[model samples]
Target: MQFDAILKQKDEIIQQLQSQINPLKNLVEQLLAEVKLLREQNAALLELIKEKDKRIQKLELVEHQYHQLTKLVYGRSSEKTSTALPGQLSLGIDAELVEACNINDGQKIESYTKIKSEKKKHPGRNEIPAHLERKYIDIHPENLPADARTLRYNRNRTIGI
Candidate 1:
């Protein structure tokens, strides 16, 4: 009879332990699912970041090309030539010229030049109108003789409104 009671007690303890372990197992499964979802999100976000980086690089290249095209269209057109003149040192072109002449059996070289034209004048400011009325006032020296007054006469002209 004592052994039967002990067996009954052992079974009750096992049932209690199983009941506690059930909730813990469920919690562990939930945590594992959360961790898996987080890992998937991290991977997706990393791929998006990589795609954005590629797009930014492409946009930067396009913007650089656009700026280059704009500068070619609107920038200064005149450029100094690097062509070797009469007294300048002939770099590598002389060898190429000699080779070409030998291959072509002494072909004569001809030079061409553009014709010069006169540049148009750019007037800076508007000219004053000649039809405007002018008023002149003359001042004589205050303490001068008649002959000295003529020498000290001052004249000023003001355009009438």
Candidate 2:
């Protein structure tokens, strides 16, 4: 009878140990899966950061070019003036703006010639309507000198143009 009782107690202890160990084994597997998921998420985040860094570098280069062009055009350092032509507009002015009475005089001359030619072709059409005819006035700027005008242009974010 004594030997039977010892055998029964040993069986019970073995059964209890297996019950506890089964749950612990399942818990460890779940923890490993969670760790793998976190690692994948971290890799995705790193790729996104690299893309943003490239875009930022490109913008900084364009801005630096714009600053250099401005210095060439205005004959001054960047810190000197708050008023400046837009980045792309400076390119237009560099191509078009001449020394004669600032930049727009040549443009105005061309427009005037076109209007006069049109008026000569159509006599009755050339008559100014009452609503269209108005006194012309020029508003002077307070900050810039008499000859200076501000032209602004927004930079295109697209690469190469």
Candidate 3:
């Protein structure tokens, strides 16, 4: 009878322990799920941070390029030259004198005219020609002294509609 009672008490104790263990097991499972979710969120946040960093780097690069472009447009337009070495002759010319000279000189010169070529019909669709006026714009270099002369002047022609 004592053995039977001991067995019964031991069985009751085991049942109580199992009941406590069931709740603890469930709690452990819940904690594990929370930890997994937190890990995933951390990974996603890290990826987002990395992408933001890349975007920031790109924006910085673009800003740097914009500053360089601004400098090119509004800054000095002349090329920098080193100091002339000994025995080197200066090739700069007086541009003001060149500009003062008149090419026409109020004199009539003989003109030689060329014969006009015959117009050839194109094989494609007849496209009417839009006779647009020509526009001329003179661009001068910056930072040149009034007495200084440019080595060469460029002539550009653009047609306007």
Give TM per candidate. Answer: 0.40, 0.41, 0.43
User: How should the candidates be ordered by lDDT, best one leading?
Assistant: 3, 1, 2
Question: What overall lDDT goes with each candidate model?
Answer: 0.73, 0.69, 0.76
Determine the C-alpha RMSD for candidate 3 after optimal superposition of all C-alphas: 30.7
- Which prediction has more favorable lDDT, 2 or 3? 3
Which structure is stronger by lDDT: 1 or 3?
Answer: 3
Give a tens-digit lDDT track for model 1, residues 22-135. Answer: 899999999999999999999999999988976786677789768766766676654213334578876554433543465556578898998989888998898778998766
What number of clashing residue pairs does each candidate have, in the order they appear?
0, 1, 0
Residue 130, candidate 3: alpha-carbon lDDT:
75
Pairs that collide in candidate 3 are none
Model 1 CA deviation exceeding 4 Å by range? 1-15, 78-161
Candidate 3 local distance difference test against the native: 0.76
TM-score of 3: 0.43
Measured by TM-score, the strongest candidate is: 3
